[model samples]
Target: MEAEIITIGDELLIGQTVDTNSAYLGQKLGSIGISVSRKTAIRDNESAILQAIAESQSRCNILIITGGLGPTKDDITKKTLCKYFNCGMRRDLTVIDHLEKIFAERGRQLLETNLVQADLPETCITLQNNVGTAPGMWFDQNNKILISLPGVPVEVYHLIEESILPKLQETLQLPIVEHRTLVTLQKAESLLSKDLEEFENTLPKSLSLAYLPNFNMVKLRLSQKANVASDLIIDEYFDKLIATIHDDVFCLGDKDPATHLSEHLIREGITFTTAESCTGGFIANRLMQTPGISSVFPGSIVCYSNDVKISELGVDPNIIETYGAVSEPCALAMANGVREKFNTQLSIATTGIAGPDGGTKEKPVGLVYIAVSTESQSICKKFRLFGNREQIIQRSSNAAIWMAKQVLTIPL
Candidate 1:
């Protein structure tokens, strides 16, 4: 099966609101073995909505429309849908009763505008909204399905789960769909794609690969939707794909870098700490983002100033005066100090000049020295990055985290 998503909103078109509904719907439809062919975001105009509906109906078996459903002047989706379906608007008593109960329980007064939300297209079946006043609409016409949902994400989720999904299961024939994602860092998209070209081309017809890149990492997702049992075949391809990119693979699954690091540390029974300068505890925060990390992560010290480096992290003042704060020696000293202070086997330290200023002939902006130290081994590397203040800090933080992971993988 194939589907298309039409997000109707002037706010979304003008960048005032983000249309997360399209992605959510597309993923949901995919899980039901319905592949989304296209996604369109249009303004809250009657002509635009009509055009989208006509265009999408011609090509897709299922068309999902969201937004423009509100008890306000600008909300005209229901009225437009009524016109398109050659029907009139009618008040739904079931919706009105649901809303009345909600308002009474909340101790709020209902206005005429609120009552207007009960109006829906006569030709479409009303799907009950459990959490909100606006009811979802489902129309099956000419062997095609069209579903209209409210713009609020939580309300949309509620209606989709409680009312829409069951009806879809009854109306459409779907196949089994599954997905597997692997996270890899320190590899560019171009390089990864080039390495996986042969592997992707050799995959079975039911499987597809997706490259989802982030600021410092890439997520390689493999999806399969078919009637035949392809689980073993899919796993085999996944193993091959990971083997092809073995050098760059960090962890297998949808978990982020922080979660993967936390699980790895927990499994290895290792404790860790952080000492930061320009990154200002960003690495520490990322490490602690995963739950149950408090037992392994002792603490972090942010020595942003030269005085703090000397007094807090116990960096030698003479070293800072001789080679500057953002130097390899300073970074090593910070890492060793934190690891010894916490008595942990692993520690990550960052010292960088992340700025649009504070550069010179010898030391330029975005000059960073990251150090990852263990009880037996410690290493430090200097980087010359190029970005503004925030980007520099972020890059430095990512580098430090990656360095720590790389250290653990090394065979001492």
Candidate 2:
């Protein structure tokens, strides 16, 4: 089945708030074999909302809309929906009761405006909102489904998961969909595509492959939608594909790069620390973002200034003077110093000129040096990255983590 998402709000159009709801819905729909054909973001004006709805209904079998469902007058989605369905607005007693109970329990007085939450289109089915006051509405017209949900993320998620998804599955018998993702590092997308050209061409008609690429890593996702049991065939193809990319493949399954690195460090009982300059603690922040990372990741230091690098990471002043703070020598010193200071089994370090400024003749902007240190050895390398300040910082941090992961894989 195909669906279109319409995310409505002045905030989204004005760039005040991001439309993350559509992305979440699209991914969930894709996993269930429902392709999201189009996504639109519009202001809360009636004309724009009507136009979006009409366009979506004309092109897709299902239309999912979120936003503009507040109790205030500016929230005109309910009124607009009533007009679109050619129906009158009626007060839903169940919704009113729920709203009253929630407000009473919280010791808040209900105002006239709050009563507007109970109004719904007469032609639609009201889906109970267990978590909020705005109930979801489902409309069926000409064998197409239209669902209107609250703008709040939590409310929309619960309605979709608890009510809408089950109803959709029952109404439409969908094919069994399965997907497997393989993660690899240190390879560009173009190079990987060239290497896998023949493998992709030989794939069965029932299966589809996509390459999702990011900094320093690529995810190979294989998807199949069919009624028959095709695990054996898919596995045979994936096994051959993995064999061709064995040297670069980092992990199997749909985990991120940090998850793989964290698992490896935890499994090997290796403690880790980072000393960052240009990356500005991004590497440490990413590692900390994953759960159970504290078991392996102790902490990190942001040594942005040359004085701090010399003092905190114990980099020699002479090395800084001779090779500069962004050089390989300083990077190696930072890695080894942090490993010793934290008594960690391994450590990573990054120093670079992430720029729109701070470029010299020899050391231009985006000149980064990354180092990884183990008990026995410390390795450092330089890179002339390309991008703005934030991108340069992000790329440098990813490169440092990738190096650390690579070093950890070496047999001691």
Candidate 3:
């Protein structure tokens, strides 16, 4: 089934708040074989809401909306829905009773304004929100289903899982959509695509391929429509495709790079530390972002200045004078020093000239060296990334992580 998501908020339009609801809803719907055709974010104005709903209903069978549902006066979604559906509001006594009980249990006074939440469009089906004050509303008009959910992420997620998805499954007959993502590093998107040209061309008619490139890696997503019970065919095709790009592949699931690295390190019981320069603490931050990562990530040292590199990571002054800070020798020294200082199983280091300036004839901008030190050996590689400061730093960080993964002897 095709779907459209509308996120309604003045904050979203003004960049005061990010509309993360659409992305989450899209992923959830896609898992159930529903494709999200478009996602729109509108202001709190009723005209904008009406236009968005009308546009969505014309093209999609399912329309999911979030935001403008609150006890405050700025929340006008209920009134707009009533006007659009040509139905008057009716106070749902069951909802009012539940709201009152919740307020009593929470030891809070219920104002008449809060009672307004129990009033919903007469023609719509009122779905009880067990976790919050705002009730979810479901409406079916001319074969189109429009579901209005609270702006609160947790509450909306509960309603989707508890009510919307189950009802959708019973209402719609959906085709099976299978997707597989392969993550790889050490290659550009253009080069990888050229290398896989013949293999991509030979794919069956039902299968489609997409390249999602980011930082130092490219994600190849393979999607197919299942005509019957064709799991074996899909698996076989995926296996052959993986084998075709075996040398470049680093991960086999839909996980980000940090998660893949964290899982690998945890499996091996290997602890890691980092010494960073141009990448700052981005590598360390990403590694620690995952839960249960403290067991694998020991610590990180950010030496932005030459003096700090000498004092903190113990890089030699002579080495910096001779090979420069962004050189392979400096990167290797940083990696070895961090591993020894932290006494960790492995270490990753990055030193780069990430800049809009600071390019010399000898060393141009985007010159980076990443090193990985393990018990067996220390490996360093150089790269000339092309981008602004942010891009350069991100590319250097990604390269360092990839090198760390490689040095640890983690299976791709």
In candidate 3, what are the lDDT values of residues 366-396, reduced to their tens digit? 9988899988899999899988999988888
Candidate 3 TM-score over all chains jointly: 0.92
Q: Estimate, for each residue in 1-412, the C-alpha lDDT of model 1 and write its tens digit.
A: 8889999899998899988887788777777788899999999899999999999999987898999999998999999999899999889999999999999999999889899999999999999998888899999999989999999999988887788877888887778788888987767899999999899889888889999987667899998776766443677788888889888887888876776787778767799999988888888888788777887887889888888888877888899898888899999999998899889999999988887888887888988899999999999998877678888887777667678777787321
Tell me the alpha-carbon RMSD of every candidate.
Answer: 3.1, 2.2, 2.2
Q: Ten-residue segment with the worst summed lDDT in candidate 3?
A: 226-235
Model 2, which residues run further than 4 Å from truth? 104-107, 230-232, 410-412
- Ten consecutive residues with minimal summed lDDT in candidate 1? 403-412
Model 1 bad stretches (over 4 Å)? 104-107, 230-232, 266-269, 341-345, 384-391, 409-412
- Tell me each candidate's TM-score: 0.88, 0.94, 0.92
Clashing pairs in 3: none
Cα lDDT computed for each candidate against the true fold: 0.86, 0.87, 0.88
Clashes of each: 0, 0, 0
Candidate that would win on TM-score: 2
lDDT by residue for model 2 (273-296), tens: 999999999888887776777887
